[model samples]
Target: MRRSSDLSPEIAEEAAWWRDAVFYQVYVRSFADSNGDGVGDLEGIRSRLGYLELLGVDALWLTPFYRSPMADHGYDVADPRDVDPLFGDLAAFDRLVADAHEHNIRVTVDLVPNHSSDLHEWFQEALHAGPGSMERARYVFREGRGFDGSQPPNNWTSVFGGPAWTRVPDGQWYLHLFAPEQPDLNWEHPEVRADLEQTLRFWLDRGVDGFRIDVAHGMAKPEGLPDMDIRPQAPGVLSDDVHDPRFDNDGVHEIHRMIRKVLDGYPGTMAVGEIWVKDDERFAAYVRPDELHLGFNFRLVQAGFDADAVRSAIEHSLAAVAPTGTPATWTLSNHDVVRHVTRYGGGAPGEQRARAMTLVELALPGVIYLYNGEELGLPNVELPDWALQDPTWERSGHTERGRDGCRVPIPWEGTSPPFGFSTAVNTWLPQPNEWDHLTAEAQLEDPGSMLSLYREALEHRKSNAGFAGEELEWYGAPAGCFAFRRKGGGLICALNTSGASVPLPPGKVLLSSGPMDGDQLPPDTAVWLV
Candidate 1:
């Protein structure tokens, strides 16, 4: 195996870069506005590099900034080679990369290889040529009759809602596993694979360190268009049929192999995939050494505060990937889900739960991602129906309400209008009502705040060199309390998930999520001992 240090001084610095590394996920639209255009831009990110560096994170994962029409919030790329004009052009992006490197922070951009926007030049050319045309072959288009011409060619449904197939004016249908505006690429096509490889090469040549592939498992489907039975309760909801045989095919291995071939030429480059599988064995298949370097573990994000449940999730995830030589990436919150603080707590009690959970996540092996504004203990903002812009909510009958609450702009300054994110009179998304209370500026001044706790915890992890490569060992603890030890580091981490005090073992407390004197453990708190 080639080490990162073997390639170059820079590559060496990135090698094993993710081990014990902290990453901050920046949702481009809500980060910061450079041109006062009411939208965040690449230059805004460059301006904030010092802020991120001071926060103690090792890297930044900037969510899709590629050229797009803003459908699905930049996931629908119109061009892979250029940054969206709304977010700044290629020169601005290059400067952002340079600035991030100056801070010793690695940058990973979101790569949407599964699909492209309907407005993409390739998709436009394919539509004009129709079926059987060379350009049309790059996408999945089928011509056939269905039941009474009213039924779709297959029973597959779009992730947003309704049937996945949309009819063209030419009397044929093209498959789109996501929104209609985001068409799924035909990965089986050699031309499609070649084109995607070129896209990867485009960024690598420009000095990108890695990519975070979106909906990577959805890239392939069963060759035969199979029908899935409709469920009784939510008869039309798309995710109800998620487990259908046609959803994620085994042929994804071939796709991974192709991606691996492209990445092999660029040593030290990493790729992380967002796979939604629940089973550990199946999920681990996507993260073999020859495949993706890391895959997001969604089980931890969905698990409640039960100690048994979290213990099982950690054990299963570790066992599944340990043999494959693939590292795991853990995230509790992102732009796609409800904020962790809100999910864990509906009120003040939930805030305590969020702080406890944060400690547990930080102690886990591999890279940990902290969503923007998470350090400030921000809760989900309540957005009115009229203010919602997520397509998933519009198409899914509002059952899920999409992810609008969590995508609200981050509040940096307490007294500034629009929380100092934009100087424009009207920002894109409405600022949360409690911005003054939750702003980073306010939290930074409070010694007992979650933001300060996060800073102390992260600093402890960085200073303890023994914690990086140490093996994790589970220890017995009381109910609602999860305890684990890292043997090499002589460190023990205990998290209290309940609302009552728990007994503490003999050891000096290195850090605590709540008030701690010598040995008493507070309710809904966490303690790290050495």
Candidate 2:
């Protein structure tokens, strides 16, 4: 409930800093660009340290900056131990970590263990080393099932689109659960396990506080790579209710167990899995004491602005992790999904709903992650078709517009498209002209702006003694409204999604998402009372 300044860095250093840490996910490629390359880099993040420190976040969960060909925007890591030249060199990364710690902000990086870029040395060698070779054993390489081995080995589909199997020139096929350029690894192989261990040590040696494991539900595939029993979902959606044999296999926990053992060697470091698991008990397994420290529960993100849906997501998210004595990791938007503002309704209504949801998310117990531009109330950009670069764009034959909408570069200081994001002619993804008012510079001066609300809310969350406690006590509300109080803290957070304003509970008002009606909490508004 307190920041490093109030809580003491020594205590965070000695204890599990992640327990109550609020992480701001830095989608590095779209955060800022220091070299005018049109793409963000490590140095850009370092330059913004003052801004982040001012914002009062405990840690930065950065997306991959590893050596890559940009096939899947750095998720397709080519060299696990090296920084991509597109970003700065190893020295830049080292400096970012050191400077961040100086700002009392720990840094956590993304680790893609489920797969690697097709250009990775291991995969490149596997492509030409011939079938049955030791090099091929590092990845999932199998013979095609057709008579002449021309067809794919199985009916499994890629998360991006089409067949998951990509045929090699030698009649053998390899598995890539994502794009063809990113091949899945054979987690059963000792070499693959050792290589992941090496990557972990390499980054930890450079002082990274932790990792946000990419596709943590993957890595271990079922034996024989069995065909999934369910129908296909819309492109890029894996809500877990779809029982796909391609992921969440029983074997995956063993990989997490191995990861935990490695991370345990580095005290105060943690691992939170990007787990897309749905079933309660199955999802809980990932966060067992011996496995991952936390797992991302996307229910909140998937839940729309409905009161019932939101409540169910909170209840389920909390219940799932209770068995393991782990806190639920909650988030409203991410690099992979549409920005929540647009999802809530879009336009002024969307902005109001998004702000209300933020109060709900921040008030909840446990660790919460905020996307880079969320504090400013940035909505998704509807990019032109030619501007799309996500693999799913081409893989799905342009049938689905991928996640580029939410990945637009954030507005820092200007009133234009680039918005001080880059000196280049354009950003990697274009920002909307309407975002001029939402720029960090503009909102910084406005006491009523979205950024100010976030700043004030975070300040209260840190300074107010009422933000303490691990669970909430629900209170009955009007048909379209809901209320809850943090158990020990006695802080009441009430939201009114109803048609009319409601009487406020008795307490000193701490903050509200919007203007209240005298003593009443208005529709689409949330209030924190202590």
CA deviation > 4 Å runs, candidate 2 = 1-13, 234-236
| Cα-based TM-score, every candidate | 0.94, 0.97
lDDT of 1 by residue, 1-530 (tens): 34333487676655567766798999999988989988888898888898788789988888999889988989899998889999999899888888898998888889988899999998899999988998887778887566545556777777777778888988778888878898888887898888888888888777777888888777787767777666542322222224665455678777877787777677767788887776777777888777887887776777777777777777777776887867667787888878878887657877887887788778777788889888888788888888788888877788657777888887888575588888886778788656787787888878888888888788878887536554688777888777888767767788777667888866777777777634667777888787
Best by lDDT: 2
Off by over 4 Å in 1: 1-14, 229-242
Q: lDDT by residue for model 2 over 217-308, one digit each (tens)?
A: 98888889887765757443555542788888989989999999888777778999998877888899999999999999998988878777
Instruction: Flag clash pairs in model 2.
Output: none
lDDT per model vs. reference: 0.79, 0.89
Measured with C-alpha atoms, the lDDT of residue 233 in candidate 2 is: 72
Q: How many steric overlaps does candidate 1 have?
A: 3
Which 10 consecutive residues of model 1 have the lowest summed lDDT? 233-242
